[model samples]
Target: MASSAAPAPPAPAPPTPSASSTTLSSDGIPTLLTIPALGIKAPIVVTGTDPDGVPETPPFDRPDEVGWYGRTASPGSQGASVIWGHLDTPKQTAVFLYLRDLRPGAQIQVARDDDTEATFTVERVATYPDDSFPSDLVYNDPGYPALRLITCGGGFDRATHAYLSTVIVFARLTAIGSSANGSGTGPS
Candidate 1:
């Protein structure tokens, strides 16, 4: 039987924090990314689309790392910031192997080179076939700081040696700087 529980309506994204004024005007080069809910804390590596226009993935030898697409908005910027990772290697599970397990309202923290972190709240997760991936929705600027984390999912094809679909986690910036429990020691 097909599972109707694949996903229900996602809980509303957590409200934007109002107590902190640490929002930066410019982009911050993301260095590290964390998802406490999933126990993921991985170093980020820069990548870009190949000449053929496919976004690059982390190297096979470094499957545990994340790839930040340089052509898109950096975290903390008012646009779509994209990050990607491998679902697995031929030999073992990789960094984003369990990406589909993340639920709405989960937090994703990206620590940047500017010493500030952009915290995003999960809005929803969706999956689509690679041939039908929504580029306009996934790549366009949404007029606010947003994030898109992508990876391969669904049944792996032995003939093509690839998964048949892409999993995307859409998030919106909900916190900046630092202050409260999720933040650091600042004036409260």
Candidate 2:
């Protein structure tokens, strides 16, 4: 049965970070994520990977909670940090239901357990096919503090019972806030 059939094409390579990235070490656990432009304010919960090696999300019962991948660098750390949230459940909408509406230059604030806050500026928001998820792009170390916010997007396939794409928002750390120091500022 060796017919003249070409093998499937390889997946696309993940994008690399530019040379401007700088070093910024992690400090504390993130407790909340707030996006003023999206009117999003949710509690951040530490989550592990699922059997599929994807970051686990909060249960349907707690649609308002967002999940941070505990295995990766915490937000505002020296690498890309990942946070995931649900778009919607069969019954209700979740924390990131409108994530696709985010635009560049938007501010994303993450409050930490130590009463500190890390603020990030949106660089880009993109939607990608789930079949070829960009693991390297989302998890890569960018030589600076970066953040990735993921949520289900695109059309829902009834037969597959899943979303066809994922919405990822990429941002870099621009500031940090603390009660002791008043506020920690980073490069513009």
Candidate 3:
């Protein structure tokens, strides 16, 4: 008689985008973040939060998309623009998987709904475990227009069967330009 193998682990819960803590800019148009190197692009949406003041996970249907907190500072504003996406999914390719391979000075572009594009360059890359996640350092940097691209990485855990760390690509705005309705945000 053949023996049965152990069942696979349950999938990790989807990340919740913060609701109450998020801050939006004066303009209602959400910022669009694009990683040309990885061909990943998505609109940052506004979310509300819980009574305990914790951010909620983003919706599951659009795991490949990245969400920016409207409450946070914009790309060109005073604080770092936080952007989050998923790593590989159980069935399909997820955006930002190659974010770990991005080198310092790599280009990151953000296009506002108002037709303005801000170009940023990678400055550093870091990894953080889920349990000890650094909320303030990653999202509260008030330096030059900064950008952080986040996703899961590290070897898959056998016990947890999920990614061990969150890969964060830290970049700063280097240039800004404008575009017409359809031209798109390209380098000047």
Question: Which is superior by TM-score, 2 or 3?
Answer: 2
Q: For candidate 3, lDDT tens digit of each residue in 60-168?
A: 4666666665455566544666666666565555666678888887788777776667678888898877666676667665445567776777667766557767778
Instruction: Identify the candidate with maximal lDDT.
Output: 2
The clash count of every prediction, one per candidate, is 0, 0, 19
lDDT of each: 0.74, 0.75, 0.60
lDDT value, candidate 2, whole model? 0.75
Query: C-alpha displacement of 181 in model 2, angstroms?
Result: 9.2
RMSD of candidate 2 to true structure, Å: 7.9
Compare candidates 1 and 2 on lDDT and give the better one: 2
The 10 consecutive residues of candidate 3 with the worst lDDT sum are 1-10
The C-alpha TM-scores of every prediction are: 0.82, 0.82, 0.71
- Residues 34-53, model 1: lDDT tens digits: 99999999999998766555
Report the Cα lDDT for residue 72, model 1: 73
Decoy 2 TM-score against native: 0.82
- In candidate 1, how many Å is residue 155 off? 1.1
